[model samples]
Target: MKKKIGLYFGTFNPIHVGHLIIANHMVEFSDLEEVWFVVTPHNPFKKKSTLLDDYHRYDMVYEATKEYPKLKPSNIEFKLPQPNYTINTLVHLEEKYPNKYDFALIMGRDNLKSLHKWKNYEVILENYSIYVYPRITEVENIAVLKNHPKIVEVDAPIMEISSTFIRKQIKAGKNIKPLLPLTVWEYLDKMNFYR
Candidate 1:
């Protein structure tokens, strides 16, 4: 049987406890054998200036996931073309890994609502499974896809914490250390980022 890997893609400006909690929950509660945190290099919609250097963000993810054997940090998108799309990443991963791994998506309830806007959403829905975690979304327009066979809603904890909030707190000279893993916190403190 192919090893099941859940891809949790994010910028991970500074990977925090909230991200770990969700990834850990997915691997523990779902069929996923491992949860790979795919660090996004450049998101088209987000401003490049606000983001930390790509390697810096990747380092934080590596530090944060060090303790968990089943959790890993992947810099796959870093080698890919700029302004990457999820469908392209998915296809690349499939081709690279071939039958060695069965890849799946780990996303939030909010992302599921916007999945329709993604490039080749139908292809993704048809080819791979998506594990959705709870989020405090205002609307429920995803009623159609909610019950789809390809999408499984995992009862993971709702993590309201965001990297943006952490950055803002750090810039304000607040102690946001507890939000991140010990190693990640130390890395951020040593680098003195966001301040």
Candidate 2:
């Protein structure tokens, strides 16, 4: 049987409990063998000034996932071309892994609203599956995604926490241990990051 790997693509400025909860829930309930945290170097929608260095974000994900064997960290975007598009990454994964594994893009319902604006999104809709978890957003725009064979709604909790919030907390010198993993918090402190 081909291994089903769900690609949880994100910048992961700092890997936190919410991310772990969602990934773990998806792996157990969504028939995914593993969920890889694909650290995006630069997201088109995000401002670069607010984002951390790509390697720093990647290493944080790496350390945070050490205890969860089913959770893997991937810096695949670093090797790819600039302005890493989801379609391009998926196509490359298809070529690299071939019949060995099957990949599904895991995202939030929030992303579904902007799916149409992405590069070659039509191809992604037709070729691969998408797993979407609920988020506090208007979903009327994604009507086409509703009940689609290739689209699965993940029954996972929607954590309101975000990287922006975490970064702000760190800058304020507020204790954020309850928000993230211990290893990730310690790693951030060691690097003297955000403050």
Candidate 3:
């Protein structure tokens, strides 16, 4: 049987409980054999100023996912150029891990709203499957992409938590234990991150 891997790519400035929750749920409910947290070196659409150093972010992810064997922290994008685009990463994975694993792009509904603006958007829609979870925004525009053969709308638990919120709490010296995994909180506290 072929392995089905879901690539859950994000900046993950600091991994949190919500991210882990989603990954666990994806594996429990979906056909995915494993979910790799493909840490993007830089997100083209997001501002660079708010991002933590790539190594720090990668370490935080590693710490957060250590307990979950199915959740992997991948630095595949680290070796790629800056301002990494999703299509390029997907293509690279396909070529590098050919036939060994079938892949899908897992993202939130918020990302789907801007999918058309991405580089080689059409090619992505034509080639890879997209598994979308609900975000703060409703899936209003999703009807536009429903016709795409590779699209799969998944109803996963939606957590209102965000990295920005967690960062703000840390900067304010507020406790973020409720928002993040215990291990990640410990790592952040020990490193004095966001202070």
Candidate 4:
């Protein structure tokens, strides 16, 4: 049997409780054997200026996930070319691993609406499965994905937390402790990150 692995791709500017929650639930509640946090050095859709260094973000993800055996981080994109795109990452991973594992792209519900805009979006849909978790807001046109055989809408906790929000709160000297993992928060505090 092919091992089922879900790719939870994100920049993870600073991995927080919300990200961990979603990833943990993705493994526990879904068919995924494990969920890997694919830390992209640069996301095409988001502005690059606001992103923290890739190594910093990767370290934080590693720090946050240290307690969860099934949850892990991947710096695969760091080895790839700049401005990493999901379709390219998937293609390379498939080629490298071949039949070793079944790779599925895990995404947030909001991404569904802009799926077409991603590079080679159709190829991604055809070749690999996609598992979407609900966001704080209702997913746009979720009913339209009902007929997609490879796309699955998973039941996950709707989290209001976001790295951007946390960053802003930190800059304002607000306490974001509640939204962050203790280890992650401690690491950020020690490093004086996001100041």
Maximum-lDDT candidate: 1
Global lDDT of each model?
Answer: 0.91, 0.89, 0.86, 0.89
Q: Indicate which candidate wins on TM-score.
A: 1
- Model 1 C-alpha lDDT versus the unseen true structure: 0.91
What is candidate 3's lDDT per residue for 77-139, written digit by digit as tens?
Answer: 998888788888888898898889988889898888889999999888887888888887676
Q: Estimate, for each residue in 1-195, the C-alpha lDDT of model 4 and write its tens digit.
A: 999999999988788899999999999999998999999998877899998888988888998988898998899899998887898888889898989999998999888988888888888889889999988777557565667998988999999888999999998999999888888888889989888
After best superposition, candidate 4 residue 53: deviation in angstroms?
0.9
- Provide TM-scores for the models: 0.97, 0.96, 0.95, 0.95
Query: For model 3, how many clashes?
Result: 0
Off by over 4 Å in 1: none
- TM-score of candidate 3 on Cα atoms, chains taken together: 0.95
Candidate 3 has its poorest 10 consecutive residues by lDDT at: 139-148
Off by over 4 Å in 4: 142-144
lDDT value, residue 76 of candidate 2 = 89
Whole-structure CA lDDT of model 4: 0.89
* Whole-model alpha-carbon lDDT for candidate 3: 0.86
lDDT of 2 by residue, 127-151 (tens): 8889988876637746787788899
Clashing pairs in 3: none
